[model samples]
Target: MSRARSVRSPRPLLGAATVVAAVATAGSLFLSLGLGLTPCRLCWYQRILMYPLVVVVGVAAIEERSGVARTVLPLSVFGLALAAYHSWLQVTQTTCSVGVVSCATVQYRLFGLLTIPNLSLLAFLLVTGIVAVASWRTRR
Candidate 1:
């Protein structure tokens, strides 16, 4: 008599990142479209960095490819930096010497503390953390 061995595959990190990215994307979209909020230049830059992540991670997850996680690090790092800078701009307000839709504009605030850029910063940090964890685990 022979016993069959069951195989267990590790969870794909990309899937986890993809789920988070999806939620982030949807949330931002809702805030902009549903709430009729205009995104400033900084906000648009953050969106540019985040929007592709949703598709990239989602595809990698569907294909069960871990390489993408490692590859996405640069983007995540830059995104984190941009989000941080954008958040700082809102806090400092620097007189916003520019015209309309200045980067320092904070359209709405959650709990009177978390501005849109602050939320973006949080989201980028989350993505960066998740991607780093996934990459580290994949190597181990």
Candidate 2:
């Protein structure tokens, strides 16, 4: 009697999460470079939080480790919070009040709708949600 081998790979959720993170990061990079939209201090902080996520998730996916996924989730969540705050500052006419770079003067908004911080907020939300879903799925 011959035994059948299992052909399934591990951590499908993690793989999907990593792909989303990579795509989000690359898309943001494209928007920044191609559109000549420079990032402010807050935007840079968001990028700092996001750029590593792509790497963390990518490595976790490769290794199929849920521990890394769990660890990285907090980073994305924090990024979301920061991006949201920055976006709010831009759209609401609030002063930066602290940073070396003033978020109030970036002037990247389009039709009073889309701003750099707004884009960052959206990206943060997307990445956080995707990673959170993947984390939940893998918790089983």
Candidate 3:
């Protein structure tokens, strides 16, 4: 009997994270600048957390860094939490009076369910998963 060994690389995962973050960032920018949609406070916060991942993850992927998760995981996790909270606010119809644009307002939806926050949540989730897998692969 012959035994085969499998090797996994973290670069691809990091690359994927970079792409996800880039797409999310572009989408947000397009919404705000191109479509003239005003972002709520929560949306701004989510952008703050997500915009940097494109550069961070891209660099890590290009360099094939082994310890990128240590830096990225915190941001990814926080973004995920914020996105979840924003989505919950929309779902529960909680009114936010902090900014001109209400956090709970659904400006647009992809399929009637995928609002901006939902998309952000999905992107953060994807980045979190990618970072986790990359970190784990490095450990092996």
Best by TM-score: 3
lDDT of 1 by residue, 1-140 (tens): 22221111113566677777787788889998999987777777778889899888777667656567666778778888998988888788765644458888778888988988888888788878877776565556
Model 1 misplaced stretches (Cα beyond 4 Å): 1-12, 97-99
What digit string (tens of lDDT, one per residue) describes model 3 on residues 63-107?
A: 888588988999999999999999999999868896999999999
The candidate with the higher TM-score, 2 or 3, is 3
lDDT of 2 by residue, 34-140 (tens): 78666668777877888888778778778766677467868888888997787777667757755655777555555767876766677667766766666555555
Q: Each candidate's TM vs. the true structure?
A: 0.84, 0.73, 0.93
Model 1, position 12, has a per-residue lDDT of: 54
At residue 110, candidate 2 shows an lDDT of 53
Cα lDDT computed for each candidate against the true fold: 0.75, 0.70, 0.91
Segments in model 2 whose C-alpha atoms lie over 4 Å from true places: 1-10, 94-101, 109-113
